[model samples]
Target: MIVAIAHSRAQLGISAPAVRIETHLTNGLPAFNLVGLPETAVRESKERVRSAILSSGFEFPSRRITVNLAPGDLPKEGTRYDLAIALGILAASGQIPHAPLGDFEAVAELALTGELRGVRGVMPAARACQQASRSLIVAPDNVLEATRVRGVQVLPAATLSALCGHLKQTQRLAWAAPAPPYAHSNLAGQPDLAEVRGQYFAKRALEIAAAGGHNILLYGPPGTGKTMLATRLAHLLAPLDDEQAYEVAAIHSIAGLHRAPGQWLVPPFRAPHHTSSAPALVGGGSTPRPGEASLAHHGILFLDELPEFGRRVLDVLREPLEIGRVTIARAAGTVDFPARFQLVAAMNPCPCGYHGDPGASCRCTPEQVRHYHSRVSGPLLDRIDIQIEVARERNWLSSTVTAQLESSASVRARALAARARQWARQGKINHHLSVSELSLHAPLDRPTEKFLAHAFEHYRLNPRTYHRLMKLARTIADVADCPAIAQDHLSEALALRRLEVAPAWPAGMKH
Candidate 1:
């Protein structure tokens, strides 16, 4: 045979797009040519494939060789195509049967010794192959990740010769067993809510945030346990469903992150440092990759020392916070990554970290405090559903105080019950309810309406803020297991909007 074809996949964002590997041998001077919009790494695969094929005891055709990755418009950028390219060359050279390549897709890197190596984004490729109703061939290193996708037939190959032997019927590769079932809940290593000494209000706000998937900001003096409170919020969250777990796993896989099998269903928690760039916070680059926001999909994204991050970097989160995805556009194309993360941020009241505390004297003028708070934009603040203050607990170290604190399991039980109510009532979480849906699910009586209107006008809330306030009230009511938004719920929701009140910082200072 002078020509042969093999199937493979390319990683684009979290998606695996099909790429056809076409190889041909012609009567001419000995040379190898690769065509398609292949990047540096993929271009280097030619040498790797040549070495791998020779090392596998296969004859290298001396005729001119040409390889093309079809759908030339889509850019190819990884070593994942090496195995398929080598297989195509062998098939075209009549060293392996080309007929058997029709039923399978391969994605793995090739070593100089003809051994197969694992590549990133195997989970996505496995899913795509399963959807296409084709079996997948991968290295032993990727077998577990590929098998994680249910119903995908994964054949683990150790070397090119072994795979060729299997294809020729001289030997057979065993199918990998399916991965173990995902655990529904994994709070084993999570910090318990009871570990936090005090800050009942902060704990309540965290509970509300987890129950309804609301974004929260916890601001206070240093050593007030804001970070501690933020870390515990993920444990209170409900486990991801099967589909969500797969989505989360695929995103992490694309980013080259792996977690223990037991933690597959547990919500992800990501805390990027203040020094992280905008692209690092939101996914972006010459070749776009999943950033921290995308990594936190179906989970929590906690930003400690929130104001310490660049203002522009923080602003980049506004879009993903509003819509549950981040769209990064480059000259090549635009990629969208799922970023439906529940944001939990911690910050001090001032640069000196003790502006409002009675125990410490103010170090700078009010302007410094205003400027520090202004680093966080108003639009960004408006998108956050709950903004509460964490205060210092003078006697929290006392044994008496620790005994009264609730455990994470207890809080998670209540939070789960609240979420169940939300799901039953509106078929979605309170945080995701649209304005129209809110009217139907969270109707308010006349008195409560009047009370909310007075507070809204008094605070000069924007439409977005008003809607978020309503969502927060609905969440509060759900936590209380109430069917309707009550006056008390509205009142508590308003109070949780710490920026809406005076003296915390001037309301005008937010802009």
Candidate 2:
């Protein structure tokens, strides 16, 4: 009797937990039994591993070989364990030395022809290997992504035979070096604010949102450049720091998203269509995968035509917005994925395309308009820090250029400076500050305090709304380079908070 063990990882949400593959051989009827809660893909690895070993010029021991994934309670899934299982068989059969096998971890899918296939969602495993301080063995195709984890020793093998030769201490494989850090240029080629004809107010709102990572809602009639403004928000923001870049890349990699190499450094901007289902928006499946929000972690989640999305679908954002994480639960268990995304949503003024437009008349009735806006519940709207209307630019065609209307480059520099101030003061952006932290960090003087109190009472503001308003004012102060919340900052934040305050959404609807 002989026993062998190899290390692998099991995919759970965005996490990859260590899995031990134990293979044993005994004197009994020729049989191969795999245990320990393996799903379809893992169970099928038996034939794949056997064929790969035999095709690679290794003897397939015809014994009652039993394989077990330890911690039988943990569900095993995917073909990522194929290489680990094959190596276990060889080490147990005396075809390869067993001692060195314990020094490394492996993740690869095996081809029947003895070639190695790259496994999806191996980035988490690569990180786990690095954290565990273990050298990771992967296919040549995966070396690029595996090396994304800086300082993790990696060996890329083209075939099982190649890997076996190296493991035998006969022909050692060359280890992979980490790829160079991706270089990112400051928002140079992206769309510029100067391209947009006018709407200085909307541009200012965007600048505040970018500086503080606050969620914003843009409401107006058609042709107001709402979508255009929302798309350019990414340009006004800072590039992802090293930690943020890794998190974004890891999330995308786990979702099996195809990313061209340097693109990972740029902040992700995901704008899902209104017709997407709730599960698609919030991330739901039998096995539970990441949704658009998780994919937008450390980035932007833009939803255009906001009211067109179902109320139920929109409601899924309530938790992730407040907690900065999304939890998907199935009969299997619950898995949480990071969802700290800045939301930028745009909606029409009413059911009719041109409800509030001075040039175009609205046909939507009062009831129809109410029903349309009702699609976005009050709770969800409350979570949004800035809710401002984007009015149609009437004079853009004939308007003169002014110094106040700067390019996105100028706005981006201001936004970055504001963000630097926030980070230096609180170690985080204004939006993430807790209620206590917001109170302590954003101190209002006697006059500003009285103004906010009077406004809150006038609006019948809820506690959440009041706190969000303060945070918004704090961001406004940050933008102005003010150390404390000023009266002007409070006034501007108050003006932006009202959803229908700016001439209403198509201000009046006929009953």
lDDT leader = 1
State residue 96's C-alpha deviation in candidate 2, in Å.
Answer: 2.1
Candidate 1 off by > 4 Å: 39-42, 457-463, 506-511
What clash pairs does model 2 have? none
Give the Å error, residue 238, model 2. 1.9
The residue-by-residue lDDT of candidate 2 on 1-511, one tens digit each, is: 8999999888777678999989999999988888885467655788899899999999998898998887777756658888999999999899999988887899999999889998877788988888888889998888888888788899899999999999887898899988887778457678788777688899999999999999999878888889889999988888887788888887787777855666767888899889999888778787677889988888899999988898899999998998999999877678888999999999887877676678889898877877887788888887888988788876787746444568888898999999999999999999999989988999888988898888767766666677888899999999999998888888899777756344343322111
Question: What lDDT would candidate 1 get against the real structure?
Answer: 0.89
Residue 160 miss distance in model 1 (angstroms): 1.2
Measured by TM-score, the strongest candidate is 1
Provide the TM-score for each candidate, comma-separated: 0.96, 0.94
* Model 2 whole-model lDDT (C-alpha atoms): 0.84
